[model samples]
Target chain A: MGVDERRQQLIGVALELFSRRSPDEVSIDEIASAAGISRPLVYHYFPGKISLYEAALQRASDDLASRFVEPPEGPLGARLLRVMRRFFDFVDDHGPGFAALMRGGPAVGSSTTNALVDGVRQAAYLQMLSHLKIEDPPARLELVIRSWISLVESTALIWLDGRRIPRAELEVQLVHDFAALAAVSAAYDQEMAEVLRQGLKDEPGEGPFSDLVVRLVALASPPAV
Target chain B: MGVDERRQQLIGVALELFSRRSPDEVSIDEIASAAGISRPLVYHYFPGKISLYEAALQRASDDLASRFVEPPEGPLGARLLRVMRRFFDFVDDHGPGFAALMRGGPAVGSSTTNALVDGVRQAAYLQMLSHLKIEDPPARLELVIRSWISLVESTALIWLDGRRIPRAELEVQLVHDFAALAAVSAAYDQEMAEVLRQGLKDEPGEGPFSDLVVRLVALASPPAV
Candidate 1:
């Protein structure tokens, strides 16, 4: 394999192994053996295990963050559900690594790792704002969106640990959460109220939201008339 | 100090030290010196460094969890603000230790520590259910409350890392989130709808909730009358 291809292959091996075992528990020889490469080759690609682990984490975070972006082609609710579906899928595909990344601990407390994880969240935040066609949300609205993302992150972290609620319900519940937050903000922040008004008006009647739409429309009390 | 007093005192010293540095970086001699005692004296109270660390962690988790409780009084929103204030205070006071405990990295990944952390979350969960006056909330309501608590926990975790929102506003925002979740759940679940009805009806026209109540009361659209 070429140098770049070899690097990518090694990272994939590390990610697969790291998912099942903590980094400290995994050895350089083990990684090399997994790849049928010499230990020197692993070191040539990554100066040390820490560097390799960082690469793996960055790759994981990048992949997860990119999944949050959705084409602005559908209704806002439908658009958000698409983003959420991708998010849940990432959590499903990488249950262990994603859990450790989201649940940062002494093992992953470096500044770089924190930034990588925060990048994913920041990307998710920007995607939601983009969906709302918002440039700068008021602090309450910003907090509302950030808190909702946190809710999704925390809930996803716990769900990966043990499957309590199934994925389909989890998706709708998250979509409903964004709508509820928008309505709640509308009650407090006028700007958000208008944002909610514009966003929900275009909610498509053809998706999984058909059932939840009635209650959601009711949440926007005073009819926004 | 007597033996029991010495044990508690030593644990307190260790907790302070662990808060400053990760467990692996902390040493027995440092804890002993901080306590102005010999290493043997430290070992006398706790078998080893890990035992002392575990004890310190337990003490911190127990203290943090106890802070979540508040007297069941006047209004649901009012009672919740009281609980939230206590929750934020724990985060403020025990920022680092609280961070470590909640993060649950390799340093403190013992099953017992996990149980201790979960216990706190459960206590907070039960307290909110109590304020709702519902002994057995429906599954949806349970998930709703649990998700909100998770939001509070995740938000507080990030806030400690950096103080973007003031503690006071964060507390009110969290209180507002619970109300919003209650309102959202009500629209679909009949039990939650009634719970929202009774809770809002009793929300006092006083305290921090005064402004938010105007928005929340409007959330129970169609007047639930």
Candidate 2:
């Protein structure tokens, strides 16, 4: 294989091992063995374990960030739900690695690793703003978006603890969470209200926002016997 | 001063200093100077700077955990708003320390420090459960509450970066965020619905939950053109 192809192959192999166990626990020998390459060959491709681990992390981070991408073609709720689906797909696929990276496990102390994680969050934030089609969001709107992004991150972290909640439900619930956050902000600031208005303009009766309205209106009435 | 009084005084001085500047920047000499004691005398009380830092951190952590304490007498929204106020008060007062602790700065790495931070989050969780009058929350209810707690944490961290939004508004908005979270969960799960019902039982129209409802209902109508 060419140098570039060998590097990509090694990164893929390292990410797979790191996903199952922490990078710290996985040895260079094991990575080479998995790649069917000699340990010396592994060293030739990368300087050491930390460098290889970082390369793997960079790959995973890019993949994770890309999961937030969605074409701004449908209702905002539908678009967000699709994003959540892909987001959770990454979490579900890369459980231990995702948890370790977010929790800052021992093997991941470099500023480069930190930047990779931050890059994912930044990409997610910009993707969200793109969905909102706002080059410059109002402060409250920005807070709402940033808070929702953090919520998604934490939700994924907590959900990984025991896999207690069903993944599908959490995906839909998170999209609803974004709506709920936006709704609360809209209620307070007129700018947020206008943003929510534009977001919901194309939403269908079966969209997440409508589902939230239906659910909330049910809450307004007396509880059923 | 007696030995115990001296230690307490030292911890107090260290925390005050740490609160203003990152603990990594504050030296033992400064801590001694601030406490009106000699550098050698500072070591006489504690082994070294790290131990003194931990002692100070323990005090701050205990105080932070205590801020979550609230009587269960008032409306849930009002009670939660009060809790948010105190939470933000800690964040506001200990700006540098709070940011450092949350962001995991160079000064903090030991498992003990991690435990202290976790202690604060765990204390806040129990306080919330106590206010809900729940001995054991159902799964969905627990998810909503935990997610809300994370929201509060991130909000404080983000708010600290730049105090662009008004502090009072963010505090109240957080209470609304909790209501919004539980509202979304209630719409999905009967258990959460019942939980939210009990929470809103004594809430007045001006309560955060009611305010959220009023705002959400307004969104159901056409925007004011």
Candidate 3:
């Protein structure tokens, strides 16, 4: 293989291992042996274990960010469900690595790792904004959107830790959490109210978003005046 | 100081340090000096750094659990607000240690630290259950309550990570989260609906819970039939 191809191959092998366990738990010798390459070659491709780990982590972040990019051609609810399905799928496949990344401190929380992770968040946030068809949202809208992202991360971490709820239920709950948060935000901010109204109108009337909106509208009074 | 008092004092001193940095970052000698004691004396009370760290962790855990213990004398909303306020206070006071504990599974993932952490959750859960006056809740209610706990924990973790939202706003949002989750559960489960109705009745109509209930009922279709 060409040098580039060789580097890609090594990173692929290391990503699989990282997904299975933390970088600290894996070793250069083990990675090289798993790749059918010599230890010196592993070092040749990557200067050290830390560099290799960074490459592997960046690869995972890229994969996860790509997963969050929803198709821009459906009802908002359907698009969200599709996006969530992809997210949950990633969680299922990379449960250990995903947990380690999200928990993120003293474990996988180096400045370099945190920046890579934040890049993923920024990507996901932009994707959600595009899906919602909202650009240049108000501060409250922005906060609500970011909080939903945070909520999803937390929910995913906890869900991975314990499969107390089924996959479908988890998906429904997470989607609802976004809508519910938007609804709550709308109650507090007029701009958010309009954004939520538009987002819901973009969704099918009978799906989870509508149902959640219906319930939240029932709980909260008329949109913030 | 007497032996028991000395142990408590040493643990308190260690907790202050732990609150400033991760347990792994704090050393036995530093802890001893910080405590105004000799290294051997520090070992005389606790076997080693891990033991001292564990003791500090347990102390913080116990303090958190105790904070969750509201008077249970007011409306559920008031009680919840009080408990949440205390929770945020703990986070503020022990930001580093709290972050370390919440970002579990590597740094604080040892069985002992986990058990102590789990004990805090159990205590908080029991405290909420006792306040709600529920002896044996159904699976659905139990799940709702436990998920709220998880949400609070995640919110705390994220809040510490970024103080984007004001402390009062964060507290209010968390309190509303518990109410919102419970409201959603009540809409689906008749048993939960009754529990919510009864719980809301205990709060003053002018308070937040009553207002939340009033708005939810308006959206949800009349006290869930």
Best by DockQ: 2
Which candidate has the top score in lDDT? 2
Q: In model 3, which runs have C-alpha deviations exceeding 4 angstroms?
A: A17-54, A71-75, A100-115, A129-143, A161-164, A189-195, A214-225, B17-54, B71-74, B96-118, B129-143, B157-166, B185-204, B215-225
Q: Is the docking of candidate 2 incorrect, acceptable, medium or high quality?
A: medium
Look at candidate 2 and tell me the lDDT of residue A207.
Answer: 74
The TM-score measured for candidate 1 stands at: 0.75
Give DockQ per model, in order. 0.30, 0.63, 0.13
* Candidates in order, interface RMSD in Å: 4.2, 1.7, 4.8
Q: lDDT-based ranking, best first? A: 2, 3, 1
Model 1 misplaced stretches (Cα beyond 4 Å): A13-54, A72-75, A100-115, A133-138, A161-164, A189-225, B13-54, B71-75, B96-115, B130-139, B158-166, B189-213, B216-225
lDDT of 3 by residue, B196-220 (tens): 7667777786987666555444433
Cα lDDT tens digits for candidate 3, A13-94 = 9889888886668889999999999999999889988788889888888999999887788688778888889999988888
Could you say which candidate leads in TM-score? 2
lDDT of 2 by residue, B57-98 (tens): 999999989988998897888888888898889889899888
* Candidate 1 docking band: acceptable
Enumerate residue pairs that collide in model 3. A218-B216, A218-B219, A218-B220, A219-B215, A219-B216
